[model samples]
Target: MALRLSLLLLLAILPCIVHPISAAANGRALAESVDAAFWLYEAWPRSQKPARARAPNGFAHHLRLGMGTPPLNSTFVFDTVGALPWAQCQPCVHCLPQEGAIYNPLKSTSFVNLTCPSAGGTGCPYNFSYGGDAFTSGYLATETLTVFGRSFKNITFGCGTLNQGYYDNVAGALGLGRGNLSVPNQLGVDTFGYCFAPRATFFFFGSPPQLVPNTIAATTPIVENPALPSGYFVRLVSVTVGPTSIDVPAASDLLIDSKSPFTFLEPATYALVREALVAQLKPLKEASSAACGAVGLDLCFEADNSTNATPPEVTLRFDGDANLMVSEYLVEMSSRRLLCLAMLPSSKGSFPVLGRRVLMGTPVIYDLAKNVISFQPVDCATFGATFAR
Candidate 1:
């Protein structure tokens, strides 16, 4: 059903392989052509299921990495909106429970506390907030970060001594945001791309390989909002539900985020989308709030009469005439006999977000140097099999 898929988007993480072109060898440049790839996995599958249906402010995707001198395997949630890469360190004042042992600085031979860059700070202290009560604070440090079999020495990362909120599954977070301290910016990666497939997503950083050669790629400009500098904003012209073209406010833009599980729209935009969808499915009775709330979703309908009912097709039209036609926004729960829309209204009726539900099975590229994002529809199963490692 659509509900499960949307929630699952907030329940998985990824594994990465760092391809180091050169590393402390023959006086050559270290990590000269550093291109990284990650193997994706569901974060909270049956075996790793949490007591709750979903985590607060869902950061479902996770990544695996090795840090320190002898190499300590660590788990991290890959967040596109987060501003810093941090891990729960030993001597923790207060930290959330996570799988595997926490990183111990004393045990690492290569660990070094970095000097604080900004004023009013003695050491390289960091405090990153991900809205609400979720926050992590610690001193910045450098370590030998390894992925797969390759290692990148002296990679800057946060050694969090204090962390709070919904991190029971991950050791910490890997920030893929646009901040200067983010992984991409710190590693000097010009381009990165994600090929999101079920169970096995692919992430390529630094000069991504050509993913969709023959397909019609939807290319859009990555608009920069001074208000939200770290977001990957795209110019959204309109959202088309079936044949109805719902015009979006010109000032409104869409954020391409990986952390969120479902898409969110402004109040007016959400109302329009919900109304348009309901009109198309008049035969089905609207589901009660209790039923939808059980799965932490909004806009659901009971589907007892219709056996072969199909969800309405939704398309996102961007400024460059790029259209992303969604095929499965309406997910049906066979047991519960309910069909639900995967999108929701923004918390503050603020900005709209394009979450992982819409981005699944799509090859999306983020060319930071060029300030563009490109995506194309493809059979991700076939793509994963071809590029499986």
Candidate 2:
């Protein structure tokens, strides 16, 4: 009887030894990496705030995404700093005139309206307000989202029944913030990266997306402030223009927001930055007579694509020695042929913001696990080959 039992036990364990299950695979649900590019368009708003009106032609970056079953395609603002993904929905109490057809939940087989309890008890009704009086109020729901040939089911997002804002030619906004409902967190991925260029921008989502070797020049810790938990705040140490470096207060926090078209500094900080820039540009022979303050720009100079007319370099020094260099010409108004310092003074007394114009051509990576943001300058034309690895 003992010999028989031992033989049976050995046979039972033999199959387990032959094909052991992978612990890594069982640990997490594996999803394919997302690598996609989208074209950016210019959007001009009626408001003259520096954040809204800084773009010469009014820059608005959008991407096409498929939602619901049978996939109704619609364009959305690819906002990195927003907290929730939202789109115009049917049965509208008050809906803005969108560019494409509004998504009707009844049309999609996979549509499911989540109640307050089902959506983490955060309440079913949600409202979001952004710069330039852009506000969207609606119910929270879950639906299928398809992007870059990958399908994500049961994704929690907003179905805007009431929206009020200047969305331009897009149906809604896609949130990529570091929140529970954001794309990266919803996908259960710890890493996501994005690079913006003139014609198009590349966005990647997955576990450890490939980046060019030695491309990451600097990194800084991402702080979570209790007052504003949704925003990405990085400590800015100082700013240097030529030989002048203005030291910011240690308590000051800088927000890295992509939705804002132009950077905005604190009132005191803007004054110093403007003084330094003016002193540096006074000697330039190509400087034009255009009044900087006339057109709502801080500084305006006539400059073309000529190499000799290049602007000076402005350096932003963050915590941990993360230095970001901005070209002088980059801050200029492209269509107006005026080199203007694209940053303005913040009227709300909120933290300073580093906007899209300063971030172009830089590959910015948000690592959630490490709680750090890494960035480096790269030739965006070679992004395909560089990140293919």
Candidate 3:
């Protein structure tokens, strides 16, 4: 029910935060009490996890640790780092349960959560890495704290980033945000296994050798300079209902393909996740001319997926009570885009339409001064979609 109690509180509170202990008790558990409370970062954008299935920043911020009973205020997300230090985090395994945490309302924001056991959690120590979001893999640490009950103490948050589009030139190359150094280094994957370990990565524009040696898929989701014609894909057609979800264009859809034009994720299920990015859009602009018969199906998508575009899934007729909605965006063919989804959202339904390799691509970026263009499946690094630069 609610994804079955968020998978039973993520397997009963993820073993108190990755634990096992044996190797000489590892300096007696790091001198005594230092199990790194919590850490997770994957502010995704081009990685595709179903656009992180809701709360991917479509606006979410409701923190109330008690009054509203914050048993898990917004299902605190971001959990994927375990190559060791007691690994095994199938994306937090079951998720939902933190007391408070769930961000992703970009005007400014990209995060995963439990920065460090504050609030109802406790206190983190360390476990870092950086690099991943669309292609997968990233981290950060030094794990901060203070989440007991609002003692924010002049709040200060900064992790630069390394999981949602990788960014943290080592805090900006020693000099700190005084940035630039990177190299072929890219983003993260080597070192920082434990000392307590849960997950972390720090870069905040402060660059440096940003990890390497392979933590898992290190760096790969390029294309954003002006490269197209390859296949083009970075879309999210419809889905609305917001006071401010970045001016709002798509509007949070859920039509699912009235016929085949396509449009999904319309409140696809999200009690609370806050921020969990992932995408797979490209509808041209909703393909028309009567469903791409000729001056129509300009829709693109060739990785084998054929397309004629248009199958139905656009409902328009507003004003009466504000009843106009969408989720249609064109850019067709992954075999026409398919998605039925359901390992457990209620235990059934939605897993057909077929198509989601995380919005597959490798080179496609057209910004033209923010007209908006970005696509990357692994590499190609090109896309300039429009930014005329």
Best by lDDT: 1
> What does candidate 1's lDDT look like per residue over 135-174, in tens digits?
8888777788775456767666778898898565688887
Q: Sort the predicted structures by TM-score, highest score first.
A: 1, 2, 3
TM-score pick, better of 2 and 3: 2
RMSD of each: 8.4, 12.6, 20.9
How far off is model 3, as Cα RMSD? 20.9
Q: Rate the local accuracy (lDDT) of all candidates.
A: 0.67, 0.65, 0.21
Off by over 4 Å in 2: 1-58, 117-123, 207-216, 283-294, 302-309, 328-337
After aligning candidate 1 to the native by TM-score, how far in Å is the CA of 119 from where it should be? 6.9
Off by over 4 Å in 3: 1-250, 253-264, 267-358, 362-389
Which digits, one per residue and each the tens of the lDDT, describe model 3 over residues 1-389?
00011111001122222211221232233323323221122222323221111122212211111111121222222111111111111233122223323322121222223333332354222222322232112222212122223211111122222223221110111110000101001111111110100111111111112122332221212122121111112223322322212221333222111112222232333211111111222232233323334422323233233233332332222111222222322232334443221111211343222021112222222222222222222221111121112
lDDT of 3 at 170: 9
Model 2 lDDT vs. the true structure? Answer: 0.65
Could you give candidate 2's per-residue lDDT for residues 33-142 as a string of tens digits? 33322211222332322111112244656667789998887878877777778899988987888767999999999987755444455546677777457777787777
Ranking of all candidate structures by their lDDT, best first: 1, 2, 3
lDDT of 1: 0.67
